[model samples]
Target chain A: MVDDNTLLERRNVVKKIVDHRGNAKIITGLGSPTYDVFDAGDSHSNFYLWGGMGGTAMIGLGLAMSIPDTPIIVITGDGEQLMGLGSLASIGVQKPNNLAIVVLDNGHFGETGMQKSHTSYGINLCKIAEASKFEFFFDVVSNNDLENLIEILPPVKGPIFANIRIKSQNPPRKLPILDGVELKNRFRKNLGVEPL
Target chain B: MKVDDIQNNWEEKLFSLLLDHKIDFLPYVPDAGHAKLIALAEKNKLLKPVVLTSEEEGVAFASGSWLGNKKSVLLMQSSGVGNCINMLSILSKCNFPFVTLITMRGEFGEFNSWQIPMGQATKKTLEAMGIIVHRATHPSDVCPLVDAALYGAFSSDQQIALLLSQRLIGKKKW
Candidate 1:
């Protein structure tokens, strides 16, 4: 079985994303501990976004549509993607030029439990994207591919899906600064809504 | 225009209304009853038609799109109201506008048993969640009610519905 905690691979991709500091907004559906890494590092002017399993891609698409020419990166889980694969077709239809949808295929819902996921079916996510006319897509299962993604991803202009196979490692149940409610409130405040 | 004229040709009118309201993003799940409206949306150049797999995702997408500063509308069937409950809570808690153009099912000669429970409860459920529920019983009433629903939901920043009854579909399958 492939290791789920491919830390080096995760680090490399995160670095490439953060190093740019352009219009890239990191969107994730993983729970607090996993998504906090992106929230803490993102330096964009506005951090209006959403979180939760099975909804990141759709959220990213919404953001990308609102701000044309702004690059948005969606970090999704294998289990999450399985729950919302229909997003692929919907996003493909929109065909936002500055969207990159990356899936961390750890073969399980790591936040809740390391339960076996539908990705175990060897479902070709690349093929699924291709079927939807999403051309710039790949599966990065190694350190080399992760590095290469940085160089290769920028020039490609369209909706791209990169599935990175990860080895599962237990993340802490709690985040350092924000709980789910706080995370949601921060996003709402960024959107100019007062506290509820 | 006569009511039949509007009912027989609601697609073009619907598209015009959405554009007039400056609604840029739309999330929907395909329903035969909503076929013409969906097709019109697909053909419209100014409006973006996004097809979601389920109604709940459509709600979440519409809410997110609103947060992103784009006006959005969710189009789905009446039974989909059930699927949207949790997301509605999120919208209500956040005090964000979420508008849905629900094609009414399992009411007024609804054949499907599966659609009954939710159909019976749709308005009550929306009311319970503090969402304004507006029904368009005839095609002639659709445009004004839809516009009103959008305004009510967006201006108040609350969840609301424009329930389009099956009669508007004009398909007598029963």
Candidate 2:
């Protein structure tokens, strides 16, 4: 269980996770997850979702299934995850070994104004994921747990779900390329696919 | 031949056409109309079939598969099309190649009144989302239309919908 006062910083956690990323493709959910990913330094491998709120995990699943040799991670928020709760079941059924989902849970919907989210009201995402039959489930709260998560992330056979409890502080936004076409082209180009 | 046997044959042909087009990902929400196709995909090793919780996930799944330099197709009923509208915008805006095969309800002696609204609107709604729509009212028309949709989607990076009329799939017994 995470103490309300000792929450992790979203940006720092994002930076640590992304810094260790090697040849791994990333898909970020809307709002803070996108901002945190961009703040970590942009990459052509990163597909940032500007408006598709609940579609992040499915996109990750598709990518993982298509390119089974590559590692794919979906970084999203609790609000976004809740909106597409059914995706967890789908992912569990597929059980893609190359896919990982990291939820930066701040217990609030930061984008729609910091209103209390379902996580704040005792909705345990880890339990839902476990029930959905995720291979690994972790409720990350401390720096040591984050370190363990980073170490195990790359080689971890998933679908793994990790919920990192974050603070309710709004960080300065670092927006990435919002042009959908450009983002798509760059991501494809990185994968050595010719753009249409 | 019995009607069910004839329908199964057509479904097998459709599956083979999809395989011929190199569609590696098959994401769908379960529908009775798509049962034959779904079962074929599940047993085939080459096809990576995923059972989506909702129709919108299939949209995202196809888009992501395309991003990974692979081709994918979505299978859903007409009623589920409404759930995919907003997510479909992502495909059109990005000009990502997308192809969906829809089994239509509420057309040609539809018994359920609930299916009529979405069934009638499926074509217009898809067109409004910038998807080129094609309909097949007979089993003979299914292959060629699906082939055309696959070609247009991959070659021109266009979103295409292939709607299979209820008249072809047969009306629900209930």
Candidate 3:
């Protein structure tokens, strides 16, 4: 059990996730997930969602299937994941080997005034993913677990899922380029793809 | 059913057109009307056929495929169109190319009362999301409308919907 005071910080966890990403295209769910990814560091590869709530992981699936050689990671929050719960089963069926989803389970909707979310009330995301057929799902509780994840993450054949319990606290907003077209163009251009 | 109700080979024609347009990813929720087309798409080695958990997932799936330099067309029934409303924002905001073929219900010979509301509202709902709506009530109308839609989407980044009228598909026996 993760103690309240000792839970891994959201900011640090996001940073570690980004640090080990290794040329993967990252998609963030709305609100804090976007902020967390932006706060980690901006990149041409990061597709930050200012509004699409549950679409992040599905985006990773599509991109992973499109460019099979490139890795795709989606970093989202518990609330957004809950909203798009069906996507887990969808992605599991397709089973893209290069796609991974990392959920920062802060147990509340941090952006919407910290309303208690389903994960706080015992909605187990890892079990859900396992049932959905994710072969490499982990509930990351400690730094050691995160380190173990980091070492295996980039090269691991996924449909991988990781739910990390973090402190439910608001960090300073690190907004990325809010222009959706600009973000889309930059992300595509980064992959040598002309803007569509 | 009309004298010309049984249209021959339209699904095959549409699938060939998709291949001609270089659409490589096909994300769909199962619908009986789309079975033949989905099968043809699955047979293509270059095409990736993704079965979405729900309709909303396909919208973002198409957007992401576009972001990664691939083309995708979403297929769903009118009932699922309601599910895709919010997710279509991903296409509108990013101006991603979208082309969807919707097999309509609650239009001509619908027996299912539960399918009524969203089925009746499908075109308007899509229009509200800034998508251009086209309906093919007959077999001859489908490929031409979809050909234009493919051009409209990929060539100019437009969101286009091709609704296959339930009449053309024949009413469900049940």
Q: Which candidate leads the pack in DockQ?
A: 2
Retained native contacts per candidate, as fractions? Answer: 0.37, 0.76, 0.74
Write model 3 residue lDDT over A34-152, tens digit each, in one string. 99999999999999998878888888888888898998889999999999999999988988888899999999999889999998888899999999998798899889989978876
Candidate 1 wrongly placed segments (more than 4 Å): A1-16, A32-36, A39-52, A152-156, A173-196, B1-14, B124-130
- Candidate 3 chain B has its poorest 10 consecutive residues by lDDT at B1-10
Q: Is candidate 1 or candidate 3 better by DockQ?
A: 3
Clashing pairs in 1: A3-A167, A4-A166, A4-A167, A4-A168, A5-A167, A5-A168
Q: How good is model 2 by TM-score?
A: 0.96
Give all candidates' CA lDDT scores. 0.69, 0.89, 0.89
In angstroms, how far off is A173's CA in candidate 2?
1.1
Q: Against the true structure, what is each candidate's TM-score?
A: 0.82, 0.96, 0.96
Candidate 1 root-mean-square deviation in Å: 4.1
Which 10 consecutive residues of model 1 chain A have the lowest summed lDDT?
Answer: A43-52
Candidate 2 per-residue lDDT over residues B53-125, each given as its tens digit: 9999999989889889899899999999899888998997788899999999888988789888999999999
Candidate 1 local lDDT, A28-144, one digit each (tens): 665532453454464323232334346667877887788666677776677777777888888888888877887777666676667777776677777898888775887787777
Residue pairs clashing, model 3: none
Which lDDT tens digits does candidate 1 get at residues B56-98? 7786677567656688998888888887775576565556677
What lDDT score is found at residue A53 in candidate 3?
A: 83
Ranking according to lDDT, highest score first: 3, 2, 1
